[model samples]
Target: MDGTTVTRTPKKAALASFMGSAVEYYDFFVFGSAAALIFPTVFFPDAGNAALVMSFATFAFAYVARPFGAVILGHFGDRIGRQKVLMFTLVLMGAATFLIGCLPSYDAIGWVAPALLVLCRLLQGLSAAGEQAGASSLTLEHAPDDRRSFFTSWTLTGTQGGQILAALVFIPVVALPDDIKYSYGWRIPFWFSALVVVVAYFIRRSLHETPEFEEAKANNEIVKLPLGVLMRDHWKDVLRVICCAFIAAVSTVFGNLAIAYGVLVGLNESITLWLVVAANAVALFTQPMFGMLADRIGRKPVFIYGALSSAVLMPFYLLSMSQDNELLTFALAIATFSFGYAAANAVWPSFYGEMFSTRVRFSGMAIGTQLGFLMAGFAPSIVTGLGGVQEGGWVVTAGFTAVIALIAAISASTARETKDVPTAALGLTTRRAQRVEAATA
Candidate 1:
């Protein structure tokens, strides 16, 4: 391919990204749902009152593995190619999820069960650390400059799709008798991931590497050490992305923590799952619209609006669940999550991907977001441990949500708008680009 004349495959890239992310997160969210609704009984049967907390900790273990996975996978993704690395991540996640399904429960394995669960969860985290960063970078590079957000938004829309699928699958599982639900029903979701993985693997395999990465390779601009370059040249942006990524915690608060809280407050387990299903189903449509809005206005405004709106609306959403009004709770769930948090979710792929050049975009986005996502991964356990899942614990959850949202919004306010920036010229302010060129010359 000519360095200056690379073919963009925006639609193909978007479709591949969507399928890969949907599959990857489908596996991931299955684990999340299981942790909340099933794992305590199956894996931590002896922990008594601590079983739920331990299960949530197992959920947090993936976040712990994510940063390390980010470094290792991000390097290969930036060095070799996003498409290849994404293929690897899909397979790794599928294998781990499948193995989780195969693991013996605590009754059969004693302490070994939860330990194995954590190990599989770690592998899931490692795979996830790279999935979004690689997918977003690939899609954004393949996109037309003016429609970057809209195309990249599909990557995250895939996540909403996955969550919806996970919830839908789990709803039936949660409805089974306790013996059956615990013994076999829960494993079906994990096993189902294998089929989805095969489907995503073929779809992603058919797609080519992004044009920007191809152009960079053609011009010999591919860095020998993407992480070194990322940190030395883009540290400020990395830090900014880390803080802005805090907004992701809002998602965990809604998806996982709130589920436990809802059940504690007398909502049916299936109804809580339906809340997740409804909210994410709405996000499937709204996020793409938010992406278009960002394209028209700018990423920062949309992102900041998402952050502040989530903070303001979260308390009401949580409080409604306690009011015995399922209709009101569902409405608030849609408002807070689909309309509020989904804006940030849809935009972050582009917002963060634009903060670095093609050479280090993968590493920068993977590392920063993974590190920030530690907050998200732990939000359920941390909040629950702090009594957020107890009676009247919505206050703790709401306060935690507000703090993270404020931090994200404030961080986003300081970012330069990149909606108008050319794809090739992204991550390069004129002065910095000149400095880099001068250093190379």
Candidate 2:
């Protein structure tokens, strides 16, 4: 190793980001699993389909909080630093999730149970508002110049880990007799977040700030209002990111809503959970390979292909789930998620993060993506209202899925190809780009 080289820093940064994201999403996914499998029964036993809609609404409530959380968290993340903001997000998510485990059910507390659940979901939303953006920004800045996508991919890969863990846990809990499952099996997952949070917090806290942030601070380039600079100089890119992020709705549709849809269509609860586990487990390996492909080719083709392919394949996956053929459903789940959508999932960290300068990268990614994710947060409820989970229900959701994917692909198409751009010169303003070009010349 070279004398001045901090050789282990990149690996450490990726590990920290990965671990932090895993814990954050683990708590988030726990709530998602419960919303589908447990909330309708435990929190609103008497309302019938209205109860399911209401339960999904509580799930969507976090998304409503997300954009707002993004603005506040993004501000501090950009100004105060990504590391501190991420630590706060981790702790906030844990507290909210733990409280959820303690909340009483509708049988005991009526509407108050769901209301409190919504409140905790809002806190989770706020914490999630910054998790991906902060982790991606920190990882992207720390990574080797030529391998940004491969390294930053771990941040999102951690999310797959979280989802997989969430599903694996809910699998057993969902299988218990209803008396036990509803009584306490569900709460176990939420309470377990306390342990995961403690582990993630220590790992994240020990990580040093990225060198890019330090350089910006030393040069007095760090702005007091990163949002202002981001708006003034990078509004177009922000909008692009927002549209592209709509692709996230596909994920929510697949991982969260599909569980309910499976149960509604008569698949066993554990089977649905297994579908999630299978897709995400395959994604754990496929995502990094997609990341490597992004680095070798470019972010554009891989992301665009992923977006379009997931749209094309989602209908089949949903339709397969509605059928009696469990084998076909499982196969479609892997093909749709692992090979198709995972392409976009694996690459967006670098694709989005590279669009801004370090001074506001966190805010830009956080605010933009959170705004777009509103569609995701509300998708299950919206599609459920549209009869998305009923027999022959694949059409409504399939259409919704395609439109969002088109929006993302179109948005991605508008951006300049950025694989060749250096990390420091990324997201340059007109003047900044000219200055960089002249310096190179």
lDDT of each: 0.93, 0.90
List the lowest-lDDT window of 10 residues for candidate 1. Answer: 432-441
Residue-wise lDDT of candidate 2 within 269-374, one digit each (tens)? 8999999999999998999999999999999999999999999999999888767999999999999999999999999999999999888899999999999999
**lDDT tens digits by residue: candidate 1, 1-441:** 453676789999999999999999999999999998899999986554478899999999999999999999999999999999999999999999999999999999899999999999999999999999999999999998899999999999999889999999999999999989989889999999999999899899999888888878988889999999999989999999999999999988998999988998999999999999999999989999999999999999999999999999999999998899999999999999999999999999999999899999999999999999999999998998899999889999999999999999999999889897777777886886666556544
> How does residue 219 of candidate 1 score in lDDT?
81
The positional error of residue 208 in candidate 2, measured at the CA in angstroms, is 0.6
Clash pairs, candidate 2, are none
**Model 2: lDDT of residue 380:** 89
The list of candidate 1 runs beyond 4 A from truth reads: 1-5, 47-49, 432-441
